[model samples]
Target: MRTQSHLRIGDQPWVKWSLITLALTLVFLLLLVPLIAIFVQAFSGGVSSYWQNLTDRYTLHAIGLTLFVAALTVPINLVFGVFLAWLVTRFEFPGRKLLITLIDIPFAVSPVVAGLLYLLLYGANGWIGSRLMDQDVQLMFAWPGILMVTVFVTCPFVARELIPLMQQQGREEEEAGVTLGASGWQLFRRVTLPNIQWALLYGVVLTNARAVGEFGAVSVVSGNIRGETNTLPLHVELLYQDYNTVGAFTSASLLAGIALLTLFVKSFVEWRQARQRAALSEDEA
Candidate 1:
């Protein structure tokens, strides 16, 4: 069973340390160092000042808005992601591969491009927006636009995670459930859901993280109309522009903390998925 890599890359421990140190240096300097620098700048104001900046109502509202967008976006993407995963995996239809590939349009498409798509579709002169304008409806410059595009950008997260997982699990268990007179809902809730729960959840977590952190396109579409349209990322930019570095950094720290919390959550999800995959193999055997 023992395969390769028992020997050092060059059969030298010292060389290995040098390589490791170099790799760490590259990672730390490029990524970690800058991140730490932001924290250093943020906290340089001391705890009391940072706390006050964090407690500011405007900053709090921005955080709330970010959470609100994530709240709406994550679930929508969760539903869409799972449905698309199931659709592609469970059935064949016209243009199936094309549609599945289109799901990833968000990845190839810039967030800015996604926003612009919405903007063009919903803007006063744009197709949908022009039609909706007869009713005086606004989507491009409001929370609706923000949420939809976030969902669009992150929609593939869950489905992409689940498809491979569901594919690997194969359809036999679900088919078995169906064969045993289980209803569609019952089979899904009992058999299908349980099997893919971890992958689904992992996707949701990733979706949430990206939703909370989204900018660029959200910026273009949101109109940044002060308290009404501002999200945390936009709010940070606003503060930075206005020379409120302390407040901006305070907000940045909150986002940073959220990112860290998500990492742990995502790690646990991966662990759960791994465990489930193992259990599934045992059951099949």
Candidate 2:
């Protein structure tokens, strides 16, 4: 008996190799080259100069303020993301779709627009500015404004991550827990938390990255006060504007390192998620 031969679609070797070469070239030029350039320029002035630039008082302050903003923003967004995901996924209500759409508005809106909106609302001539001024509360061009815009821009990260995962999980386990007389807090702590923890963490990592790296919106609201409102990105811009190329690149190296570290963590999370899914499949099999 003669066996039928298999035919492969898109089996042109030349086409495959050409596409691979193109992709590699683009990645090298667009990503790897810029990354290496940052380090090369940063150390062009030698270790001492690089160290001095990094340890300058203003640079230290900028780093500290960036960390502070990330610390404050991540937790708030994490809680809000989880709560919003749970609310929308586990309940049916009027305007539920609209609420979810609104939550996503930030993602659709430009970061610059997000900052400008806050400025319009809180600037001295803005609607509530006079009221806040009467109370001696500072918003625009202050830490509060920076914090507010950071929160607004990063709001969608966790919620976007959790919403689909929670929806796919459905309410079966939760319902079972409730039927077993578990309190709301008990159900969440025991039944729900474990299921969503990985996704929650993934979201937190993303939120932290964006919070620290955010430039556009924060720049608009921060007033770019050196050693004060100057986040790391803003600090880099200030350094570059002052013709301190080495200083700017040095400051930028820190952010690049952060981006690299975040990429590493994200890869690990994705690997673990894949492993978890494979293990579940094996058990079912």
How does model 2 fare in lDDT? Answer: 0.91
TM-score of each model, paired residue for residue: 0.93, 0.95
lDDT by residue for model 1 (88-144), tens: 998889999998898888889989988988899889999889999999888888898
Model 2 — which ten-residue stretch has the worst lDDT? 1-10
Model 2 ranges off by over 4 Å: 1-9, 281-285
Q: Which lDDT tens digits does candidate 2 get at residues 52-111?
A: 999999999999999999999999999899999999999999999999999989889999
Model 2 Cα shift for residue 125 (angstroms): 0.7
**Cand. 2 TM to true fold:** 0.95
Per-residue error for 128 in candidate 2, Å, reads: 1.3
Which one wins on lDDT?
Answer: 2
Decoy 1 TM-score against native:
0.93
